[model samples]
Target: MLGICVCLFAVFTHVLSQEAEEPVFYTCTEGYEYDRVREQCRDIDECALLDDACKGGMQCINHFGGYLCLPKSAVIYISKEGEQVPLPAVPAVPVVPAVPAVPPSQPQVPRSSGNQGVSLSSRTIRCAPGYTADEQNLCRDIDECATGRHTCGPEQTCYNTRGSYTCQCPPGYQKNGDHCVDRDECALTHYCMHRCVNTQGSYYCECNAGHKLASNNHSCVDVNECDVENPCQHHCYNLIGSFLCQCEQGYELAQDTVSCQDIDECSFSSYMCQYQCINSPGSYACECPEGYQLQGNRVCQDINECETGTHNCQDDEMCWNYYGGFRCYPRNPCEAPYAKTSENRCICRSQAECQGLPPSIVYKYMSIQADRTVPADIFQIQATNMYANTHNTFRIKAGNEAGEFFLRRSSNVSAMLVLTKPLSGPREYVIDLEMVTHHLTMNYRSSSLLRLTIIVGPYAF
Candidate 1:
């Protein structure tokens, strides 16, 4: 009996083993499922097999007939630690390789790919780091000129080199030289003056020392000194490179250059006038004194004023003016009463008392001061204008023998006079001078020298 029960248990165990190896499927409304792999039953996520597997955002499900497939939205995920966890973001669906259209009999789906082909798992593009199609396309080189990818500034030129281009100045420019070197105008001696200013490679023209350049041309001109402050003492004229100074007339240059002096015309005869001319710095003149008219001989002479009527005498008198002297006449109407008829006194009947008179009783005494000097041609006046009386009958006594004599005279007017003749023999002198009326007289003697009175009278003072 114990052997029979053991044999039945072996058969049951064999049947269960066969069920775990081969699982059975049911229709839409199926029976309860069996799973013998772990000797326990498990539920299925059946929404994956539903007709409309999910809503737009969730999958729909149907469970075995009474076990309906439900949407995944109704379920919540749980962590291994038993805490509720938020649902993770849905992963983007992987794009599969596009298949070409096949005929009706051909297999619609592809077989599993072999490992020999390139796999997405090994490529960075498949690892979620995606690539752009433009980058993958064939890359063209960056043309500097075409794309305007140049570093050169305006007015500069650019040249292309491999991988990069270089900046450059235009023609006639050098690397070390001024990139835009101006042409060196001063290098050639064409328009330069004393010096040249080099700017870059070019220069401007200028004048040299003591010279000025003309606006029209490159020629240099000499500075004109005469036009300015006048370097010359006189007229100034400009020359090519210099000027000339000339001393003007009426002046002479001194040792020092600055000043001019008036030349003494009198010192030299060149510009002197006639008649003892005198010269001034710029002119000349003549000089003459009084009492002397300019004569033909150019000298002063004692005037014979009496003959010339120059003496101030009475018009009624016949004046016999002489050289250096004069004589006067009252028109002698009567002869000398004392004169003898025949070497003897005339005894006229009515004039008996006047007869026998000694011939012309003479005045006795005379004295004078006579030392004198006179001026000449170039000298002053008043020294040469005078006269001496010679015709008067004033007698001198031989007995007196006077060493001195005096002179006096009277006419229509009185006079005061200075002597011109030099005194010689006379030293002691005395004189009595008087006239009864218009006939004035002077009496003098050798003893009267101590009181020789030169009496003055009325005249043109």
Candidate 2:
């Protein structure tokens, strides 16, 4: 049984060998021939059969009867004829499946088509989550009065719209102190046509009938009634805003302060009477009182009843006016001076008031009275046109009356009067003096005014 099995196996092996083996023949179309049939018929790696057909980093991959050029990872053998080259082990490579090409005929989607499946929506903008339609539409201004966001500032009026609100002021409220508050136009100053009546946002006024508003709106001025018609009978006086009447000429203002009346001047001489005057109502006439008549002057003058001896004066005397009465005096005693320099003048000799001063027909200022008891400054007197006849001696006296005046006992060389004395107010004094009796007669005359002034000065009886 073992031998039979062996023979069958041998036969099987022989058949397989014959089927696989082929004679090695170099099939060259020309020239080269192989001596070894068996060797030539065997497949050879190009690196092996043709002698190193691949360069470095390349390998020969044996196929059915031919070989393929592969990368170095496929090389299993190395050559000696090339050298005893070291054989780099060929690593087993895994087979990769082929990728199938997509057919160009398949339909492609168009870019213009709206994105449908698998397209994300564009991001949306939304109001804060708590907000609603009442707040805004498309995120616009919101009406707080409607949206419940309204909180008006103090004293401010809030008006709401669809999306917003306005802060305003009610009537008479003005923006002041950076806020809306009650306004007082009169705060600056009271401006009114007449009486200022303050109202909401404005003012009114009450004016008298005779006055009107000034352009500045604060003053009430007089209405010109005279331009329209004359309401006054006589003179019209214009007050601040009204008129009054007053009488003119002979007329007088009546009991009514603004009315007129006619004057009756005959009560105290007529209005035109020069000699007499009167007060009357509104008008007056010119007329004479008793004992007088109209003259070239408007005056009622007295007639001289005595020119015809209604009363008579002495032949040498004259009549003159003594008020409404008559008087007579010696005309020769009052004759006008012959020379112009002596007009209205008279001459007289008077006494003196001091020692060393002579009595003459001259003027002097004062007279001596008592001693230092009466004071000296008040005792000054001038001796007029002195230094006449040599050897003439004089004496002066001072007293309350001319009966006995004081004598100037001495003269002070330094002062006119002692410093211990000062002048008093006006007082009466008397002067008395006498010229020293002498043989030679000397004539001494002061100025004519002095001559008359002595008469006007203090006199002794």
Candidate 3:
């Protein structure tokens, strides 16, 4: 058996050498060729060889025995050999088998005796259309797509099949008549939540104002302006496609609505504070002037230096309180013809040894705030000695130069002193009030005097 196998190999080698010496014929498919070194059919790379294999910005993808044209942005899968494969949109193509070599039609007969003659049968093999034979005498499928032998147009892709090829549109395109055209995906389907922009052979989503594109690239969501921009000067609130700003207490929004401004509480009204109104950044304060204190939030009250023991009056001086200040006066405000009877009063007892003078002289002291209302009744006087059926009259005997005071009679024996005009001070006034009584039945008259001192303070609290 081994010797017979060696004899058959030598005969095969001899046949191969004879075939080489003659014209050897190799039948290969359109996209394949017989490799002389490997003695087999191999695929052709049309993409590498043809410069215009893929037109219109399409990418050329080489496959087994064929090639594909796809959009530049199309998604593709990779095979184990690191070759690109078409997406599902493109129809799958079957791999074509390798071609085989064809044997010669006639064989040489060996010259030998009848007993040594080997009868060999002659077999003829032929390939069908779109198929070819390789060195192994096997029929292989043709790749007409890779060889540009298909009927597909420039806008279409060619897929190779067993012994055949089919034409189809690439991704992002649809077949229209004899050509492929771009499909308007944005107009056909509502895939974007906000807005859709149609591109060449594709579509994309967009977002409106105050909205942002979601991760899916087809939906929109709120942008949260407060967190992103922080437009408010003090506080900010975000809403749908808008935002709002707010200020803290004692402040208000400015004209721009994004900034905060101080609200001048003092300018609203004059009565906001009794003394003075002070404005701050976020609030206001009420303040009192010298010698006064704030009573409440907006009122000022006098600081009574005498009552509060904050005065510097000496032992011989008496402390007096006025609206917003204090003053010191002599403990005894009496002059000649008057004797001290109390801390604020004096009286004359003997009346100058019974001469032509009033019988008694009294002293009184009082203080008032500056700018006191006019026509104010300040003091009163009455006859100390009155007889039966007596008529009496009162008068400001002195110190009436500015017409600041006048005496009005209330009854037959009593009268009141009135201030006729407003006075501002740090000032002092002295007046002598006198009264005279007449006994109508006896036809005799008696007189007396009352000394009054008025001190006016500096301010009104």
| Between candidates 1 and 2, the lDDT winner | 2
Quick one: best lDDT, which candidate?
Answer: 3
Candidates in descending TM-score order: 3, 2, 1
Q: Write the per-residue lDDT of candidate 2 for residues 224-288, one digit (tens) a residue.
A: 76555566677676766777776788777777655666767667534456645454455443455
Pairs in steric clash, model 3: 99-134, 100-133, 100-134, 100-135, 101-134, 101-135
Model 2 TM-score, all chains together:
0.29
Whole-model lDDT, model 2 = 0.40
lDDT digits (tens) for residues 88-201 of candidate 1: 333222122222322222312224433321233532111101111123221123447546787666656665432344566543233444245544545633445455565663
The alpha-carbon lDDT assigned to residue 441 of candidate 3 equals: 89
Candidate lDDT scores, in order, read 0.35, 0.40, 0.71
For residues 79-116, write the lDDT of model 3, one tens digit per residue.
53445554454434323343444344433332432421
Error of 2 at 83 (Å): 99
Best by TM-score: 3
| Model 3: how far residue 177 lies from native, Å | 4.3
- TM-score-better candidate, 1 vs 2: 2
